[model samples]
Structure formats: C-alpha cells, structure tokens
Target: MQKTEKPFVEVNNLYKVYDGFSSVLDNVSLEIARGEIACIFGPNGCGKTTLLKIIAGIDKDYQGKVLIGGKSPIEVRTGIVPQDYDMTLLPWRNTVDNITLPLEVNGYSRRVLREIVVEFLKKMGIKLPLLSPVYKLSGGQKQLTVIARTLINKPEFLVMDEPFASLDSSHFFQIADVLKRIWNLTEVSTVLVTHDLVTAVLLSDQIFLFSPKPGRIVHCEKISLPEPRSVSDPLFVETVNYLQGVFLMGGE
Candidate 1:
C-alpha cells in the first residue's frame, strides 16, 4: 500500500492481558491500507482470536492504539465472521433470518432485506434453503450462511477469524473463491486470522506472522503473484515452500 494514502486499519504498540494474569499480545504493530486483504498467520492457541477480537472492537480491555478508517475500531463498522459458526449464528434462526439480523436491527424494511439477501446469495452462488434453521444445515452450509450474513451490509472492511478452519478441503477452496469474489466485488478491506500457511499465501496481499501466545508479529511481507495464481507455478511453489519451511523452523 502507498504510504501517501491513509491507512484503513492501524495497530500500534498493542498489548493485551487476560484476568490480569498473562499477556496475550506484546507490542504488536501493523498497518493495512484500504481495500487490501491481509492475513495474520500463527499457531493454534496463539492469541490470534484475541488479537482479532481487539481489532474488531469485540474486546476492549487491552492496551493498544487501533484505528480503522481514521477512527478508533469501536467507532467503525466492521463485518466480522468468527471461527465458530455455532456461536455467531443463532441456531433457531433460518438462513435468511440469520443474514438479515443486522439489516432488521438497523431498520431495513422486510422487502428491502429480502431483496438484498436474495441478490447477495445469487451473486455468491449460495443455494442453501432460505428458511432452513441454521442448526439443520451442514457445517459448510452454516459457514456459508455466516459469510453471507457478514457481507450483507456491504461493510467497509471485513474481519474473519479462521473462517474456514471448520471446513474440509473441498469447502476451503469453495469459500476461498467466494471470499475472493466478494473482495473483488465490494473492494472491502479485509483482515483474516489463520494458521494455514498455504491458504494465507494464496489469499493475502500481505501475510503477517505471529509468535505463539503473547502473539506479537514476528514478520510481515507482501506476496507478489499474478491473479489466478496457479499452485503448479514455480513462484507459487517457491513462496509457499519457503514460508512453510520458515514457519516449520519456528518462524525464526
């Protein structure tokens, strides 16, 4: 991203501790420009979710300067998809109802909400039953419902905390395509947390590596690759293998 342009999201000297016992973050700092898709990569139990929650303003008891769109994170409207769909989506609600919750809460009329959701589902190629309760759907379908809900408002930025962690390989590819399509279509700035190196390398414009718990960023760099990235391509193979090796070597 160009330094001349204002950052879409910025984290400076961030630190977080829970129950006043142990630190979850340590002096973390980063910047993401408007419309950029960035990913935080780290091991499990590494405070990735904590960091994301802080960034999304879901958790405020932390020491940090987090800004989104020139304002504090809590002041900004962010679309968030948490890793656990079971927790985020209401089990009693149907797919359409789930996606329209935000809209309904914000006073969108019933007709307008339906139109928005129907159009969004069509655009994303999602075919789940609109009235099917969230609990009745398969894991992949439930995740897709969460994705649709996250995007329904056309939020200026998106925060995804390991959104695909529960899915199988086939669903991972499918949702990856959906996310890419959403990014291209809406130009929404996105920040994702994941432990999957290949997925991070494949989707992100820049990848931020994190340490184990007390998760400070260990490293960050842009991934330069042409669109329609081919896994068989030499550059793709080289970058993935290099990152995979670096991560395996404990991100030293």
Candidate 2:
C-alpha cells in the first residue's frame, strides 16, 4: 500500500464576517496537495478574493483555520499577485528593477539583482526591455513583471487574484502561456481566484466553484484534460460547458 501525502494547504470550516455582522464566507473548507494548482472560481462578490486573501495571510480577522505546509499562513513564505497591476508595479521603475523589487531590500548590489532577474527570465523563456519603465510596457508585460517579482522570492505558495482580469484575448492567452510554463517548471502549490472558467480549467488541477455572497464551495471539479488545452477541443469545450451548466444550475 502507498502512503498518503498530507495536504500542502488546508482550510477548514472557514468563515469571514465584516463589521461583525456581514458574512462573506461561510463554512468554507478545502485542501490542496503539494505542487498542485487550485483555482477558486465564482461570480463577482462571491468572496473569492476574500478567500484568497485569507490563504495568502493578508486578511487575518476571519474565523476558522488555514494552514500551509502544516503552518499558519504568516509563518509560510507566500507570493501575491493582486488583480491590479497598474497599482502594484511602480511606474517609475524599469522592468529589471521591478522584477527584483522583492529582494532589493536585502542589500543586494544592482549587478547581482540584474543578473538574477536576467537568469530567471531566461529560464522562464521570457524577454523584456530590462531598462524600460514599467509604465511604458504593455498590459501583458506589466503582469509578467508582477509575476516575476512575486516568484523571485521563490515562495512556498503563489497567490493570484484575477491576474488576467484586465487583458484582452491576445494578452490573456499570452499571459496564460507564461503562467503555464512557470507552473510546469516550479510545480509550486498555487491558489488562483478568477471569474473566468476557461482559465480555471486550463490552469488548475482542480476548480472549486463558489456560490453567491456568503460564498461556499458548491462544487469541486477535477480537470483531467491534457496540457496545452484549447477552447475548441471537444473535451475542453465539454468541460467548460459542464461547468457552465453547473453554475447556471446553482444560480437557479
């Protein structure tokens, strides 16, 4: 018999209330295996972001338990990529500067930072204008910079909330490709929050669908489609459609 591995992340009976009265999350519970990617999918205002925050150890005022690697979130190394890149990246900083921001405070020399960013980007098969101000980069480039910065620390877990929310189809797929490559290389346990079902199916090993306000996981679907998934593939289309139907039914 094979030994069972413990979950890398665990959220049990989670609950979040604001102002001590407004409930946002209700009895939420989940478990993620090491190196697996999990996505929280739901309609807007369904407390998806709130859940991500809890897991990321940003919002700690909630009730219940969330553990990463058998440790509290604050005790774990975490990287966060928020939905808003425009606000996250400093406009005055260049690409390389932005990518190395997370580790700069450690007193590393500029040459070391540049070399680190260059080597990391090379490994990820990503290319960017090292000296170009982030404000001048495209939407995809900005998001890429943010992701690079987040991963520079090589945290135990990656948390992203709607990272591609603002991109067009072209940029959306581009960013998705980059993210897939990164995950394949790092196999880092991740929790991503998104309203896009296609993204959830394409990027995650499992998708957790949440109900409306006072969110709860109504369904958990495992995605078995092979990599390089397409929106037009029959099975891919079927899975997306099935999830859509599930959502519709939940709404009804």
TM-score of each: 0.95, 0.96
What digit string (tens of lDDT, one per residue) describes model 2 on residues 134-184? 989998888889999999889899999999898888988888888899998
How far residue 173's Cα lies from its native spot in candidate 1, in Å, is: 0.9
Show where candidate 1 strays beyond 4 Å. 249-252
For model 1, give the 10-residue run with minimal summed lDDT. Answer: 243-252
lDDT, candidate 1, 1-252, per-residue tens: 337898888999999988898988999999998999999999887889998998888998888799889887787778999999999999878889899987887897887888899988998777788988889998888989998998888788799999889999888888888888888888999999998878888899999988888787888879989998777789999998888777777777
Lowest lDDT sum, 10 consecutive residues, model 2, at 1-10
* Model 1 lDDT on a 0 to 1 scale: 0.88
Counting clashing residue pairs in each candidate, in order, gives: 0, 0
- Candidate with maximal lDDT: 2
